[model samples]
Target: MATLDIKLKKANKVYKEGELVKGVICVDAGRSEIAHQGITLIMDGSVNLQLSAKSVGLFEAFYSSLKPLQLINYSLDIAKPGKLPSGRTEIPFEVPLKPKGNKELYETYHGVFVNIQYSLKAEMKRPLLAKDLQKSCEFIVEYSNKDAKEKALSKPVQFTISPETLTNVKEKQNVPKFKVKGKLETAVLCITKPLKGELVVEQCDTPIKSIEIQLVRVETCGCAEGYAKDATEIQNIQIADGNVCRGIPIPIFMIFPRLFTCPTLSTNNFKVDFEINIVIVFQDNHLVTENFPIKLTRF
Candidate 1:
């Protein structure tokens, strides 16, 4: 009953690119001593795009091995070939979390058909006729530039867009034109910080029912040709349940999740983008929407 496990030195399993990741590999030979080859620790990071066999055409199937993708596999020696003495032993190792030659690394993300992952793996190389021990730990990696953040945040995101700009409201219909004004403290937002802003509605002919701020994510894959979008309401401030006049300013603020959400990023083959969508619903079932694109980063 041989087992292997990975433990990180930091409490949080988050790291930046070009940083050193330190951890320990715990190997336990339950109730018996074991003899085997050397132990190795691997740092593997890659962007994997998987295609179903049934969906592949004849030409694609013939050249399946040449699919476009990026991969990095770096191995470090942990111990020499020897026999294990006891029940449990710990080996400390540190490796740089960097791709070859200053290449940009996209934030870790897992999607339905596409995925970018970085993992720290440990393996016990046993001789032939025996199963080897293996363990893996996944971590999050974010790219950040303080200089870029400063430049992005130097100016506020101010825009006045009519809901009809990108809305489905019929122009022929007598739906009144609504104007939405948005102002954010900074155009650049930090992942661990809360986004603070105010939205004002004016020139509204219909009764305002609800105002909501939505966080939208756009995922692009396959050389920016294939894409998927998802949106969720992050902040909602009800002005009036039934009907109300305009001219009142509504406050909006939402904090991004510490985990499971990546910063805005772009790469050659994959990218993640974020935006703020302002929606105003009227009492007569009329909708006015505005999209304000913003930059999200970790600084």
Candidate 2:
């Protein structure tokens, strides 16, 4: 039996646009030499989108029209009609990281309905009556650091959530009075770092049961005919439980999960956005939420 594998030079398997993806293909044949017709290496990067369950019927036509947006496609012939020795053999390779014609390379993201991925596949064709060997591995792509200055100059966003400023309240008279103030360290967040902030409950007529921070992903997919948009919770973290103290600051900290998030992106075919929701649950089983739209960057 024979085995094949791919190993990237970078242990982290991360690269930016315009860099060279350096790697090697390893082949191991037990006790006998292996014969192959040809060996090829292929690299691909694409964005895949899917409609949520609720949007299935509404966008039947759009769903059928949905196709993977191929950003990069490159192939290399590493060996021609090669033969492997009895032991392990390694073949070095280097492929340029570039996007297709006029298209741009987006950061690799893994979402419920939208996904951007980059991978390398290697194939070894065998002669008659022998099974071929193949192997594949994924790599991460991040945006270049060109907006460092802009991110450094970003200002913190201060917000206040009170009953008077709340929206969509039909029975305002029945609602309890409350005032909460907070500031997001910065609206422009670095995806590789933790989100930082703090909040305080100035005053409240009713007792607080819990306070939580909910991270949501808003995805939109569609064409000129129509589009389907949905918001899904990626994670929920409770900062306070059975809250009793008032006038004390509560720190807000959250780490952006890899694969589940990327720099906020927008394209003609789809959009990937993120938001933070501050939820306050009252002891009486009532809840009030404050939402904040946030921008993510590689800087």
> Which segments of candidate 1 are over 4 A away from where they belong?
49-68, 110-114, 127-130, 144-150, 159-168, 172-180, 202-209, 224-246, 258-263, 283-286
Q: How accurate is candidate 2 locally (lDDT)?
A: 0.90
Q: For residues 213-241, write the lDDT of model 1, one tens digit per residue.
A: 77766554443233333343444544335
Top candidate, metric lDDT: 2
Evaluated at residue 93, the lDDT of candidate 1 is: 90
Per-residue CA lDDT of model 2 for 1-299, tens digit only, reads 89999999999999998899998999998899989999999999999999989999988977887899999999999999967899899999999999999888888899988999999999999999999999999999988885232353366999999988778677888879899998999878888888899999999999999999999999999999798999999999999999658989999999999888888888899999999999999998899888899988777
Candidate 2 local lDDT, residue 217: 95
Work out candidate 1's RMSD over C-alphas: 4.6
Assess candidate 2 and give its TM-score to the true structure: 0.94
Cα lDDT for residue 37, model 1? 97
